[model samples]
Target chain A: MEPQLNLVRLKTMYEKMVLIRKFEERIIELVQEQGRIPGMQILANGQEAVAVGIIESLNAEDVIVSNHRSHGHLLAKGADPKYLMAEIMGKSGGVNKGKSGTLHLAVPEVNALMTSTVVGAGPPLAAGAAFAQQYRDEPNITVVFFGDGAAAEGSVHEAMNLAALWKLPLLFVCENNCWAGAQSYSQHCSIGNIAQRGIAYDMPGEYVDGNDVEKVYDLAVSMTDYCRKGKGPALIEAKTYRMRGHGENDHQHYVDKEELVFWTKKCPIGNLKEKMLKEGLITEDELQVVETVSKAIVDEAVAFADESPFPYAEEALDDVWVK
Target chain B: MAQLSFGQAVNNALDLAMSMDESIFLAGEGIGVSIHYDPNMPSHGLLEKYGPKRVKDTPVSEAAIAGLAVGASCMGLRPVVEIMFLPFITLATDMLVNHAGKLRYLSGGKSTFPLTVRVKAGVNFAAGCQHSHNLEAWLAHSPGLKVVFPSTPEDAKGLLLSAIFDPNPVIVIEEMGLYWGKGEVPEGDYRVPIGKARIAMPGKDCTLVCYGGATVTALEAAAILSKENIFLEIIDLRSLVPLDRDCLLNSVKKTGRLVVLHDATKFGGFGAEIAAIVAEDAFKFLKAPIKRVAAPDIPVPFSPTQEKFYKPSARMVVDAVKSITG
Candidate 1:
């Protein structure tokens, strides 16, 4: 039997994941070419499926709040790539008019409400967003994308408890990528499965192989449906790996060479392509088109950002007050 | 017209603002129950009127409460959250300073985040520095926040209403000592314009500027000085950031002498800012060096005796004015 949104979303998820991977790699190219993008560059290069698959399962009105490495989630949630790319380049056409840069990009039109660099901060904010939707009797849900590093923060636990207690329409999506700024998950936390912490908060806790896009999407669909039905919040721990170091400057000497090899072999994009070919979902020729289209779109985004002008220095004082 | 205490005035303000605006909601730790019915003293009886949905009681999660307020405000709801004490604000500062104050600016003015934070402040409680430290200057120093401190019941009611409606994050610093102090208050829909100072007791000899609990001391000092034939003009600086600069400069220009007072520690206190402004703008008009009467550089002690010493008193204000006037 076909799972809910399984086969139909698979092709789209593959395309979206390719675009996300391409977008993240483009930042690396810019780093080497332009001596970095004028700000702290954190790439979600390997965590592509977790972002693409879960976002693909969400509805248009659903809200998503994310953290520093948020480009993947923003792109997958239908943010305009040109504007987002411009934001990364510190251009006036950026989503926040270049004020937020890559870290705190907020695209309200896509229901991507907030992106904060503060670790573990997004969940509490998302809980509040969920509170608003619930208070308004709205059917939409708010999803917070945070990493395993954020899970160790007390605020995350507080958000979970608060959301569960108030029965808020929130879904906490944890991308457990095993490294929190050079510190391994084992060093930071004793709890192997963050999803199980949902039990302490009295919510459903589920875990899935993050590199498997289909599994992540199916689980996200179920949880979003649960929250939309006013069933309160749930937690999903997508076990994955960070293929590179934490930031643009990190050389990953602190990381294990063998661990990198293992995650690279399990690369979400590669696994998805293999699965699609094995299932006869797309022929080799169709796959090539998807890759070409994704690359061209990313190239266009870079061009748009390159052509976008930087904001004037005086503009910094403009938006401090709403009046 | 009705007589209400400073605490009752806040309740009146919340009741009126919430009724007039459906989008307005209250959230904090035990805001419904009044946090042991103590510092929550302002939001008493609101939970019954608005119910759990609007008048929310939260866990002892300052970050969550602050973040919730920021998050809800972003989504078009007006949340007036109570962060119980001043020092605890450090826990919520990330959400308040980084997100709440910064979000509207980051949005390039495309959105308005209209939320109010009711902060309990002062040193008179003798509850130690943890619960009683004053942080108005810190809030004011942040670029995107509006800070107001009311020393009387009428100003409390009016300022809270105005703060609740303002399009920026307005921090209403309530002096815990003045909560039970009573005064005449307008009944409904009254508003005191923020960033404006009031002349508590006017005179021509010297200008004494103060706010929150210190306003009481300044008024008392003016009375004592007046009896001694030294007429002290007392200006209650209601707000810190937008700071009634013209009223202050004009007052300093009139009296030709200035003294600033607050309960916060002397070094780097908001009083220093006031002193600097007068020193810069109205320097030619000054007849004496600007003086500041403030708490010594120390924490608010828990002992009532040391706490009394830790507080800025009328005697301190009078002594400061005397030194500058002499």
Candidate 2:
């Protein structure tokens, strides 16, 4: 049963997750080295599996709209690392030519559409893209990656209701990292599980352990298939943890030390590495190669960003109109 | 040429544009109804002709639907969205002002949000307060938006076509007061170029710069002032941004006197920008200080008498010209 799960695909997923983890880790160092406080540095340290596993099931033709914590989803959805790294460093060679820094990133080639700064904003956009695809008679699906905090927004509920009513090929993925800024899900939301809200919209609501990459990957595959076949919109709530604060400036004194320790132990990358080794799906040497390759790629990306030139001041006036 | 009301002209423009381009779709509330609600509304027979797929009647989620239009436009579709009333556009500010207007700039010119929003503004049918706020000034303030307020039925048809085809986001501000106003519109294809002002009634003494509902007042004032040998030049500023500054400065440069007019309140109204622009650049050519004739700083009242006073009328424009040209 383990061997039938496709070792090559699983191996790729593991490597992608490693790249996301290492990419984030390196960005923090870069921000620190710059001697400036990172303004809105949101790292998806523990939420790697949710982005990687779900994105693994999507093709380049499909669309994905992400929230502020979007680097993981961008990388996992096949966004070029060099451009993304350059973008984060505010270089002209960035994906948006340095116009959008950490919060907003759009790579259209892979159908990785806009990443919004506003919470709950991406779902409506995802539904819009899905509407176009459906209208054009295309088989593409749209996935919106938002957090538990965003699910509490009226915009998200409105988007969900509209998507369901329109029967769009849309999937709403809620990465319940528990803490929205300093507030916890318990305090912010009246409902226990965010997925339960999907029931009101007459859609299937599924929850999975976000720490387990295999479970998320399997569920995403089935869900994407269901949506592709035009079964209407669906929702998936990944019970994940926020390993770090909301932004780089946050001290996270409001977070429990025990909760941090618990999530650290259940790191998605560590869990996958252990599962693969015990199942004899991958060798110890193979795992080391994944780390080495990921580090080298990240190193190249950082160097590219470092050497890239900043755009001219006059260039700001350009791209405002499409004439 | 056929005589069409402003509403019929708007309907004809949508039908013509949609027929030409399959990518152009209509999304909004109250657009697909059978009854003629607001003279020449966008819906009428559109739903029946184009079906639900093209003429999308969305739920009252302006933010989501507006975002949907922006999202769809970014991915290579032209969406002509309607916010029903101008006041409801506040609910969609996130999508309209933030995303639609900023996406192209944020993408460093790689992406374009070719989304057109139709907003019915002003008071005429006693749709007081929430339904009758003149807010084109709010939209014109955004950099990326091409805000066009067409006065006549012909201009409405031409401007709506241009707005639909523009690669950038455009706010087509339709005056509720002018929906039933009839005018001669040319047959077949024609476009009233966006960002260009039209000389509604040209004169040499003073320039009356106005748009939307205020155009009617300005024209009436021009006729009344003509009887007194004032001979005011009436310039209907069709577009707000990419403003026909050339036409305005040329007119101001010729007349040496200017009066900015609008249905919006006098305080921080769009007229202020016109006044400031003329004062800054064309001050040397001015014989008198720039004057503004606009609605008072208050909401559109319910009573017909109060509503009459709340909106700027032809009498106010004449009074303003008298004060400025004195």
Candidate 3:
């Protein structure tokens, strides 16, 4: 059944998905043109719903700890596109002062922290942030975004156990895009459903249609509300499909071509636009407006990144040690 | 003055800190339980008195425990995390190195992590390789962390209190072997600053420098040598990082001979760092080359017979001191 979502919320969700798509496309284009970014990881394919659904329901004070595939998460959480692009370009005006490249972009103003390219590293950090929130008696929830592959990691289970046992206000969003690099979910994880692992910790867990943006948003909103009300931790497994390869260089030879074609048909953005049109929630003209605005924003970000000066050589040593 | 066990002294330090500042809380595995390892555990009665909110019991996730402590400390709370065993601390090094140690520096000094990580080190009761490890050298090599290994009950109370109040990440290595060992501890409210070494014994012929359980062994060796007319000086390095170079150099200059002792593997151990400092600063004052008495570069054997040979003993310290002063 279709989840009840307001027109305004649906549009906002569409805008966020479009922004993520365009932002990732722009990043891929830039990387193809440029030889390398010292420390960058692109999460371009299958994780838009997790980022949009959770960020839309969070307050400005709420903190997010994202995995390597965190561009969509950061952008949706209000990190400036210009600074984020500059950061990927290794410019001085970038977030983290260019010290943390793309993989480790930390925008404290937006309460977003991205970790290194190590999988399953953000849950512990999210638990820490949640602990901090509870200690300070702040009405904020800490959301951690991880991939399906991270479900197999011992650290993830450990963090889940701690969050549940301590009753910390933590929301764990698993972007189950069905692949961990070249390996499929079946090869990596024994449990068919990753969210079911939450039961071991005695926390609330749910599975959502990741392609359905409204369903994802509704679940995330409800789960976040449950956590914010001091009901402890919850986990959401957004079962989605990656329309493209894992990264820029991967051809995804391991994935069946027919399966790829099937997921492409269920592209999250296309499905959302179709739903909006069928419900008469948004006109074609409104969709066009969002596309134009998102494209313009991506173009401006590219220009800003290209024109921005590279970080000073001395800045390399500056952020190495905080005073 | 109240004389407390080493474990009780550490517990008292936490109680004092929590009483003085409401922002301080203790969190770790089995912390809320009154009878975790022993019937009369040091953390016993704390959960009932302070409530579970302050004395939290976490799952057996060292990484999460360390990360939570780091994050909580960054948000203006002093968190003391206890890892049941020192070997388990390796799981938390990522958070310790990436977040706790580098957060303040990464944020351009906008953040400060006042975290105290407590772990018990040493081979006692045959806990085997996984539990018995003297890994302070690994933490000492890191720039942003403060490493403290207190030997006596007083130093344990003082150093732990100071670590809680200090505006940095401190790793307090409590030797499990010395937990039951007693010493004089001041009654109420005392703190010993980090980076200070104390002269446990004063003599002229040779200087023996050590900390943690090795201090007791060194003192025993010093007493044995004194009966034979060999006056030995013993300096206990209460804190490893920001080491007491002045005390070490002064003692080395006066004694003209030195013997460094530590329970960790001899190669690349913290004692080697002390040897280097003396060699660089007081090389000319030395009448004999500095000697070191430490465990060989191997894991602590499980067998009692082998473990005794693996750990540096009072006889080894005495032998090293006699050889250096001869």
Winning model by lDDT: 1
Provide fnat values for all models in the order shown: 0.66, 0.68, 0.37
Superposed model 3: Cα runs more than 4 Å off: A1-5, A113-117, A135-137, A243-246, A277-280, A283-285, A299-323, B36-41, B97-99, B102-111, B187-189, B202-207, B227-233, B245-257, B277-287
Measured against the true chain A, the candidates' chain A TM-scores are 0.97, 0.97, 0.95
Residues B193-260, model 1: lDDT tens digits: 99999999889999999999888888888888988899988899998878999999999999999999
Two-way lDDT contest, 1 vs 2, winner: 1
Measured against the true two-chain complex, the DockQ scores of the candidates, in the order shown, are: 0.71, 0.78, 0.34
lDDT of 3 at A49: 74
Which ten-residue region of model 2 chain B has the weakest summed lDDT? B34-43
lDDT of each: 0.89, 0.88, 0.82
For residues A1-323, write the lDDT of model 1, one tens digit per residue: 37544666788889999999898889898988864478778999889999988898788899999899899999999998999999998899888898888888898899999888999999888988998898899988999999999999988988999999999999999999999988999999879899999999999989999999989988998998888888889999999998878888888999879888898999999998998899787799999999899999999999999898899999988998877
Q: Per-residue lDDT tens digits of candidate 3, residues B1-326?
A: 78778888877888888889888889888888834555225576678789888998887788889878876775668898888878888998887876777755544444577899988888755767888888888888877888899999899999999998888899998887787766788967799989999999999999889999999899899889999999988999999987999999999999899899998889999889999999999999999988989998998889989888888989988888777666
Candidate 3 DockQ category? acceptable
The interface root-mean-square deviations, each candidate in sequence, come to: 1.0, 0.9, 2.8
Flag regions of model 1 displaced more than 4 Å. A1-6, B35-40
